[model samples]
Each structure stands twice: as C-alpha cells, then as structure tokens.
Target: MKVYNYARIIYYRSPLLVQILAIAFSLIIIFGTLLHFIEPDTFPTLFDGVWWALVSVSTVGYGDYVPTSVVGRIVAMLLILLGTGFITAYFASISGIAATNQQLFLKGETAYKGNEQIIIVGWNERTKGTIDELLTKTPPVKIVLIDASLKENPYASKGVHFIKGDATRDDVIQKANIQAASMVLITADQSKDEVAADMQTVLTILAVKGLKENVYCIAEILTSHQLANAKRAGADQIVETNLLSSFVMINNVLSHGTSPSLLNLLKEVKDSKVCLQEAPTALIGATFLDVTHEMLQNESSLILGIKRGASTYVNPPTSFKIEEHDLLIAIIH
Candidate 1:
C-alpha cells in the first residue's frame, strides 16, 4: 500500500505531457509483448514486434510484418481497436486541452499562480503604455490587468493576464493572486465621473490592502481633494495626473520643445534610477559633504540627500549631520 501510494504521488506530480506519454508507452510495450509471444515465427525479435505495434497503433499499415496465425490476428485486431484509437484520442486531447486553457485564460476565468507580479487595475491607454514599458524589463515582469469593462484579455498576445471583474471586490483581486503581488496600481476608471473614479481607485486600494497590507500600492486621484482619501485607504503613492500634465504643458508653452527634452531625459535615465535606501551604518553621524564624497568615490552613487523620518532634505548643508535612522536618497546607476 505504501509503494502504491508513492507511485500515485509520483504519477500525479509529473507534467501532463509526460503522464500521457508514459501511458501510451506502457500500452505500446504491452501490445508489443503480446504480439511477440503470439507470433514468434513472424516477428523474430522483441524490437520487430514493437516496430509492428508502433506502425499499427499509428494506423500506418507498412505491411512489413504480418501476423500469420489466428491468435496473432486477434492480438493485431485488439491493438487496432484499442491502441490505435487511444493514440488518436491522445493527440486530440492534447490539442483540445491547450485550446480550452487559452480560451479560459482570455475569458479571465483562470487565476494567476505566479509570485512577485505587478497588478494594474483599469484598462486605459495609459495603463497599456505602462504595461509595454514594464515588459521591456530584462527578466520579464508578469502583469495582471483587472477591469470590469473588457470582455476578454486584449493584451493576451503580450502575456498580460486579465481579470474581468470589479477591482474593488475582494474575490476579483484574489483571482489575481494579490497576496503575492509586488505592487498594485489602481488607475482611475474613466467610465465613471472624476469624483467617482477616484472613489473607485481608493476602494480598490482598500481591497488590495485588505488581502495584503504590506504590499505597495499606487492610486490615481483625478480630484485634488480625493488624494488624502486615497492615502487614507492605504495608497502608498497618489499620481496627480491633471496637476502633472498642467505642469508639463505650462513648461512646454513657456519654452517650446521643453516637454520633448524632458521626455528624452527621462528615457535616458532608465538605466539609472533615483531610489531611497536606509542609511548605511558607516554613514551614521557623518556630515553631508563627507558622506557625499565617500559615496561618489567608493560606491559611484550620488548622495542626493538625507530623509529623516517623514521629511526629505535634498542636498542639505555641508555641516548637516546624518542621524542613525535616516534614509539616504541617491541616484543609483
């Protein structure tokens, strides 16, 4: 019983393709063994019997080794009736399962089972561009897009999984495997009014936090007043699209091609990013100039400034001291 249990565990643990192939091979071996014993004169060796069985099971009548006796013919008839049909069904099942799984995935019925994936809510042009940029990453990031409007996964070809449900709902977020996600982005739903969209974004953030509180979340707040609401609902960052666009537009108007230059600069800095990290132990109590010089000389990273608690100071005075619990803001290349 223990051996049988162990065999069952091994069989179930194998991939579907390997399990199917094992069964097919087992059937072929049994049929070949039967054929060899039934007609020793016709099939002189076990390999010859296996060859005949293989050809018969594939329905490819080569006519190389014909069974002469009545018992041998019965064995051939059984192989044709069972083995051939099973082999035909085997190929059909493989194709059918693959097609069915694809359809299910596109329909957003399948749950994402991977870890450290990025989940973006709302299906808009901005989200689409974000997904394209994230996909350009070297190791390939898995992104799950959740929206209630889309009938099926529009970016299925690009390997983006879709969940066709309201992002504010716990069940829908669970389908995305939210607990294992690295970050969640709640884009404002354009279908709703500005205020309602921000409300929905905040709700989605709450739903995501309910499942995993520590997961970082970014929400888009169309209305300025809703920014605080989004943060209160567990949003780590809030993107003010209108304010940011207006800032860029005004700069572009004041100086022609300013937006283009800024965009190019952003693109150039893709390989190097501004990041905040806990201050190293050695940098404790060090002056700004001392830390900056040491960081540039040894680490090649620019020391932007020190972040003490909730306040961030960029390029503090040369005499300013770094505390023990301060975070260092730097541009890492």
Candidate 2:
C-alpha cells in the first residue's frame, strides 16, 4: 500500500501529457516487438514493425505490411484495438493542456520565469498608462504586474505578465521572479488608508530587497512620516505622491497655465529620461557653466544639476565647481 501510494504521488505529480505519451510509446514498443517476432517474413525488421504499429494506431494504414498467419492476424487486431485509443488520447491531451495553460494565464495564476523584467505592483489608471507606454517602445520592455485586487490580466498585450497576489509576501514576490528583475515599481495600495498603504509599500520594499539586495526599487509613499522608513527599507527612489500632487495643485492655482506646459514638456521628452551619470573626469574642477556648455556642445545633453551623496543641487550657481565624486544629473537623449 505504501509503494502504491508513493507511485500514485509521482504519477499525479508528472505532467498529464508526459504520462499519456509514455503509455502510447509503451504500447507501440510491445506490439512492434511482438509483430516482428511472431511473423518474421512479413515484418522482417523491428523498425518495420514499429513503423507499422505507429501508422496503424494513428489510423494511417499504409498496407505495406500485413500478417497472413492466424496468430499474427490476432496480434495485429489486438494492437489496432487497444493502441488506437491511447494514440488518439495523446492528441486530445495536447489540446487540453494548451487550454488549461491559457486559462491559468488569464487567471493570473501562472508564474513568470524570465529575466530583466520590470515588476510593477499595483493596478490603477497610472499603472495602465505606464504599461501602455512601455509596450509602445522599440525592442519592447518585459513587464510583470502584481495586484491582489485584480482577477485577470487587464492588458491583452503579450508583453505583460500579471500575478495576482500581495506584493509584501515572499511567495508572491517569487512568483513575479523578483530575483531576476531589473527593477521594481511599487505603488501605494489604493485599497488601504494612506498610512496603511505607505506601510504596505515599505513592507513590500523590504521583502524585495531581502530577496535581491541589488535589485533597484522605486516605492511610492503617501505619507511624509514614512519617508525615512521607506529609505531605510532599501528603496532606491521614493515617489512622494502626496507631495507631488500637492505641488501640482499649488502650481496650478498660483501659475494658472504653467502646469499644463510642465506636463506637456515631460510628455515631449518621453523618449529621454533623467539619469545620473558619472561625472566626466575632465570636469572634476571645471565650473558648472563650463561643463554645461561642454555637454550641450559635445553630447547634446542638458545639464540638470549636480547630485552629491544624498543632496541634489538643481540649477546651481554657474561658478559652482564640479567635484570628483559628483554625479551629473542630466537627460541623455
């Protein structure tokens, strides 16, 4: 009974298609050998017997090989009767597996096992827009989206893989293949209150960094008090949604028409994004004005600021001297 249960465990663990093919092949081998030996003249070779068994069971009888002896005729009849059903079952299993896989994929129960994929944790208008933009890029970016509230993949694009789960859990993060990801973007959970959402975001960052310390993470923090906690949780960048929204509203009220232009300006430069580049060795002691002029002339890049350690100086004095370890904040086209 123990041995039977062990065998059953392995049998169930094995793929359905594999078991079906194994049974089919076993049938072909047994009959092929029997036919070859039972009637040597008609089926001279084992290869000939296997070919006939395969063809006959598949319902493509070529009539090249036939059995005349009564015993051989009986064997042929038995092979056809028993083998055909399993052979037909093989094809049926293939279609069934494909349909099941498609269903699992649509239900967001499938795991993504690829590398360099960008994992986005949230489902909202923002995530939808971001995914749409990523899909439109040349040499398209691979994306895996994780959201507990979603029941199915929201996008029909093959570029996105969706996993429905809590991002703060290890099992879900592993399903997203976070260890092999290039970076992760975590948005505040809209289902929770502001404080709880920020806590969730920070907890997610901790879970991700614990698995892959070097994987870059950008987490959204809804409350100001959680800013230090998010930083401590190993987020490479923090998107202060509340601060940004407040600033946008303030700008719209004060400057009237500038907010639209500001947003348009960002859209216009979508192809190029702001990045931190190692400061040119030659610009170590150069003035900000000189370095800016040189970059604009040589690289067609506009210098945005100097980032030193945790501080950023945007549009600093033209005479500010560039330091050895300063990172040049610029939009490289």
Best by lDDT: 2
Cα error, candidate 2, residue 310 (Å): 2.4
Q: Flag clash pairs in model 1.
A: none
Report the lDDT tens digits of candidate 1 across residue range 200-253. Answer: 888888899999999999888999999888888988988999898898999999
Q: In model 2, where is the ten-residue run with the lowest total lDDT?
A: 151-160
Report the Cα lDDT for residue 255, model 1.
Answer: 88
For model 2, the superposed segments whose C-alpha errors exceed 4 Å read 1-14, 69-71
Cα lDDT, model 1, residue 268? 76
Which residue pairs clash in candidate 2?
none
The CA lDDT at 16 in model 2 is 78
- Candidate 2, position 231, lDDT: 97
